[model samples]
Target: MDKSTEEKIYEAARKVFILKGMEGARMQEIADEAGMNKALLHYYFRNKENLFKAVFKDIFTKFFAKLKDTLLSSATTREKLTVFIDNYIDLITANPYVPSFIINEINRDPKVLSSLMFENFMEPAKVLKLFFNEVESANKSVVDPRHILTSLMGMLVFPFVARPILQMVLFQDDKVAYNNFLEERKEVVKNMMFKLIEI
Candidate 1:
C-alpha cells in the first residue's frame, strides 16, 4: 500500500511536471492529480524539484535503455540502425509528450542535459563512429556511416519532433495519415539509408 501510494504520487507529479513544467506546477495541483493530500505528496517527495528530478531521470533511463541495447548488441550496423529507428519510433509514438517533456526540461537545465548526453545516452553515436572506423579500415567503398546515421535520425526523429507543425502542414489533422507516414517510414528510412551508403 505504501509503495502503491508512492507510485501514484510519482505518476501524478510526472503528469503535472510535464504539462505545467517545474516552475509552473504546484504541490496542491500534484496532490489533487494524485488523489492525495499535499502532505502526502511532501511525504514522498520533499519538493517539486526533487519530484521533477525523479520523474526526469526515470523517463531518461527508459529512453536510453532502448538506445543502449540497439547500439551495443551484436547486430550489423545496418541492422542496428533499422532496429533503432523502429524502436525509437515506437517509443515516441506511444508517448507523444515525451519529446516535448525532455526538450523543455533540458532547455531549463543544460547541466542535466550535459550529464545525460555524456552518459549511456550516447551509445548510438559511439556505435556509428565505430562502424565508420571499421568500414574505412577495410577500405570499403562507402559513404560515412555518420552521414547515414544523421540522415536516418533526420528522417525518423524530425517528423516525430515536429509533429505539431507537421500535423497542420502535412498530416492535416488526420491521425491515420500521420500513422501511415510513420509506417511507410520504416521501409523508406531503410532504403534511403542503404542508398546513402550505396550498400
Candidate 2:
C-alpha cells in the first residue's frame, strides 16, 4: 500500500517487460525483481496484463505529451519536424524495446491500442494542419497530410522495430555500429522529409 512499494513494483515490472516482453514476462519474476512476494505484486497490479498496460500507457503518454508540446510551439513547421524526429529517435534509442513491444501487442490485439485511457493528447489534427500549411507555403499541391505523417513515423521507428535484422544484416551484429546508424538516421530522416516536402 505504500507509494514507494508501488513504485518499486512498477519499476521492476517495467524492466522485466522491456527485457522479456508481454508474453515472456512472469509475475513471479517481477515479484522477485521487486523484492516482494507474488501476492503483493498481484495486490498492486491484479495481473500481468494490467501491469503491462500501466507501463505501456505511461511511456506513450509521456512521449505524446512531449510531442504535443513541441508541435504546439512557435517554431516553424520544418523546425518542429526536425525537433520531433530528433526527440523521437532519442526516445526510441533509449527505450529500444518499447516500439517493438507496442507494435507487437497492437498487432496481436488491435483493441490494445484503443483501450488506453489517455485522451487524444497528441492532437494529431493540429499537427497535420502544420504539415498542410508547410506544403501550401511551399506552393505544392495539397496532398493528404496523413501520408507525410506516416512516412515520418515509419522512417524514424522502423529501424528500432527492425533492430535485430538490421543489426545482423547491416552491422554484422555490431551494437555500437547499429547505435551509430541510429544517430545518423536522425539527420537522414530530417533531410529526407525536407526533400519530400520541398521545405
The top-ranked prediction according to TM-score is 2
Q: lDDT by residue for model 2 over 5-73, one digit each (tens)?
A: 899999998888877878899999999998889999788888878899898777667766777666777
User: In model 1, what is the error at residue 4, expressed in angstroms?
Assistant: 3.0
Overlapping backbone residue pairs in candidate 1 total: 0
The sequence of per-residue lDDT tens digits that candidate 1 reaches over residues 1-199 is: 4559999998888888877777888999999998889998778787777788888878877876777677667456667667876787888778767777777788888766665575645765676677667544433456665665567667877887788788778867887898888778888887876666655
lDDT of 2 at 131: 56
TM-score of each: 0.81, 0.88
TM-score of 1: 0.81
Least well predicted 10-residue stretch by lDDT in candidate 2: 116-125
lDDT of each: 0.75, 0.80
